[model samples]
Target: MCDDLQVSYPKDFKWSSWHVSCTCFLMMTLKTQSELITEINNGQNFSSEASENFIANTPGNFNAWLSENRESLEKRKSKPYFLEENKKFVK
Candidate 1:
């Protein structure tokens, strides 16, 4: 049938309704939004000295360097350092 061909139907095709279930099933194989955000944030903690060194080596604007690395920095910002002194005693 036409399904055996690699061609796709127009977006407005009525038959596209049937593909919705298949799409949803495939989507389930990927991580959810919150999990993806958490994974990217966790990845920031592992950025290497080489990465920082690369940014430092850039010839122009430091702001551009920051913009390029913003996602990594944002992820790094989300991590909190735990220390004994920072703990609050519950009354």
Candidate 2:
């Protein structure tokens, strides 16, 4: 993931904010994908059991989960870049 991130966003770009945001976004996406893949593998033999719990837990389950939890979706709510973390956006 780090390798991909580094390759995707060159270090010398003038848009430092864009580079940082893109790096964070890519990392988060990679994490989510890895987690989903792990879940799929672990549930392959007991898909029904896992599906039952997942369905019972969330009202709309998968769709609602993805909709609410997607970083990519939330990213579009504002500008493509973010100010430094640990502080509010200056705007």
Candidate 3:
């Protein structure tokens, strides 16, 4: 996870107290993609031995997991770029 906070604002952007506070809060709370993925994996609990074994042996489990959790995932700032680039490959 990156500890550095890299916020980009327009040249005419003004620094207000509310803006500053929100920015600070977001910087402190946001997690990187890998970090979020690890967190989700750590929190997962299998209900049955068969299900656990299936996930463990699955070749595309990571992608499957990401797809399943896509709606709940908080995408990073660069998500737009990725979505654009991969749009052609997505069904």
Per lDDT, the best of the predicted structures is 3
Error of 3 at 28 (Å): 35
**lDDT, residue 49, candidate 3:** 32
Of candidate 3, the 10-residue stretch with the lowest lDDT total is: 50-59
- For 40-69, candidate 2 gives per-residue lDDT tens digits of 788843433343223222123323434554
| Candidate that beats the other on TM-score, 2 or 3, i.e. the better one | 3
What local lDDT score does residue 82 receive in model 1, on the 0 to 100 scale? 17
**Cα TM-score per model:** 0.19, 0.17, 0.20
Clashing pairs in 1: none
Q: What digit string (tens of lDDT, one per residue) describes model 1 on residues 1-91?
A: 1132223222222222222234321111233455556658888333233222222122233234445655765577442221122223100
For model 1 the TM-score comes to 0.19
Off by over 4 Å in 3: 1-62, 73-80
The predicted structure with the larger lDDT, 1 or 2, is: 2
lDDT of each: 0.32, 0.35, 0.36
Which portions of model 1 show Cα errors greater than 4 Å? 1-60, 77-91
